[model samples]
Target: METVVDGTGRAGRSGRRWRITSMQVLCALLVLAILGQDLLREAFDAPVLQTAATVFVAICVQALPFLVLGVLLSGAIAAFVPARALRRVLPRRDSAAVGVAGMSGVVLAGCECASVPVARRLIGQGVAPAAALAFLLAAPAVNPIVLVSTAVAFPGEPAMVAARFAGSLATALIMGWLWLRWGKLEWIAERALRRLPDTEGRDRWRVFAETARADLVDAAGFLVLGALVAAVFGVVIPGDWFSSLGEQIVLGILVMAVLAVVLSLCSEADAFVAASLSALPLLPRLVFLVVGPAIDAKLFALQAGTFGRAFALRFAPVTFVVAIGCGVAAGLLFLGGVR
Candidate 1:
């Protein structure tokens, strides 16, 4: 059974509380528009609304297909790739293992949220914690949609594409290595891998369907949570915040990294947020992009619940450093000088 929604009314409701609330808020805005007229227009028509819409749509479009892609690949891997085979493929040494693990994301496409369960399932099936950690960080950023969106975000900067991919890969691998050396697997939640009650004896197609359906169901609430966060970030956090940071580029990047961790916006959608930081120069904003997929508040929360605090504490900071370094290099190459 799909955990978020089971192809039923309750499930659908679980998935799209925003569509409903959006209507409610929009209707209220319309009412305010009629009664207060110009006042409502003045408040609602502020640039913030436009900016929010721009960032919101960018994230949703970029993430949804990739999320679907990731979930499907994860499903196929679970249903088809024998656990024994996976165990063989994942390397044993820490750095090499991380490299092998991180590269696995090259084939799977997904957002950070979607990547979590897949990683958990892999671990359950005996894929090393090192490899699983790498996959969790990589699957979101290196996905096609994320890279393509990076290209879009930078307009003519083809290097942005390379930067996003390389940065995401570097962070994931290095972080994986760190975790294997210093982190433990005690962080993953037990309830995360429970089997669905009635799906046995099904065909591969059915298995895939069941997996995808369950993913969509399980992720619906999270999707709503992400959207609401984007919506709120839309209303709060003025653009001047970035502009005001001045020359604290490293500090700024670190701050945004923290924000990325907290917000846990989908990889697809995070680019627009990074772009809107036009005031913050390119490097830090790039760091925002790089750090986001690997560590975000939403992602951290999920990880803590499913992967454990020990894993998170070790994994998050190392991933942050690697990603920031990548962003700095990319900025020097493409952004001229973003110090």
Candidate 2:
């Protein structure tokens, strides 16, 4: 029967994958053993290498709990919630749904890392992909914790917080509309569309646990990879770039935007980082805050893992451009030419 053939094929593939993973792990261990502690110490003695390692560990430690929370929430949504019910709850019109999704982001208090898996779950659960993506972009930027932190970080600059909120919200909405208009379903990885099997009977808890564990493992690996990449950039990027204000305003905006993507700071703390860069004008800092949550190295890795490389490649660049423009417009309107 066809079912038997399919099952056999699946088992064969699983076995091959397991063997490959084991071999890879064994090889890694062997290499590490060969290098020994003295080599590692020698390497770490270099200032740049040491700094990168420190950043890698710090990012992993800070993000691990939120990543766990994200996977667990995603698993709960998959196991207990009905896609039909979610569809019913969302607005009928896609445009309206996008707006609703952007606004709904206020409820999620976690950082950018948390939103990646959650957005993928939303798409798999029958929500419009564009709307879900909007929520993903908005959540970390516009959440109450982020807003409040911004307020506290810049005590006297109420306009800074307002501009940040407005710019981030605008970026989300614009990306949603752009996706709806131009995005192709095939651009998303096929794996993202596949639904988690139902566990209505005795296997509900097992399903939840398995789903969460698998997502955690997969996402955590990519998160670590991203953190490593970010660490390298962190060491390479000059500190003087933040300290020295360039005469050309456009250059400052562009540098801040690029730095945001490179830094990959947590949304809850990014406001403080931006605030600490007092040498930069409010406009550039606003761009940094808005762009960090929307698209960063870690977020891009998470997206590529969750959605697809094709999707991330197209999405991240567009988001960067949109965030910059939105930040500029918002700055002009709210900060009145960047105080």
lDDT of 1 at 24: 84
Q: Which 10-residue span in candidate 1 carries the lowest summed lDDT? A: 192-201
Best by lDDT: 2
After superposition on all CA atoms, what RMSD does each candidate show versus the true structure?
Answer: 8.1, 6.7
Off by over 4 Å in 1: 1-88, 91-94, 185-200, 203-241, 333-339
Residue 137 lDDT in candidate 1: 86
lDDT of 2 by residue, 1-339 (tens): 122236445522223233457458879998897879788788789988988888778766755655666567556654665444445667979999999888877765445776787677778877899998998899778877678778877899999889999999999999999999999999999999877553366476776787777766655665566576557656776767644654567889998899889877666656655665566788888998889889999889999999999999999999999999999999999999965
Task: Give me the candidate number with maximum TM-score.
Answer: 1
Write one digit per residue (lDDT tens) for candidate 1, span 1-339.
Answer: 234656554643234333555458779988877899877567667787766666666656655665565567656755665444545787666567678778877766666766787677767766777787888888878877677767766787676677678777878877777777766545544554443233335587777777667665544445445655665565686657656774777678778777776766667656755664566766777777888887777677778777677656656666777778876676676666764
RMSD of 1: 8.1
As a whole number from 0 to 100, the lDDT of residue 121 in candidate 1 is 70
How many residue pairs clash in each candidate at the backbone level? Answer: 11, 0
lDDT of 2 at 36: 97
How much does candidate 2 score in TM-score? Answer: 0.67
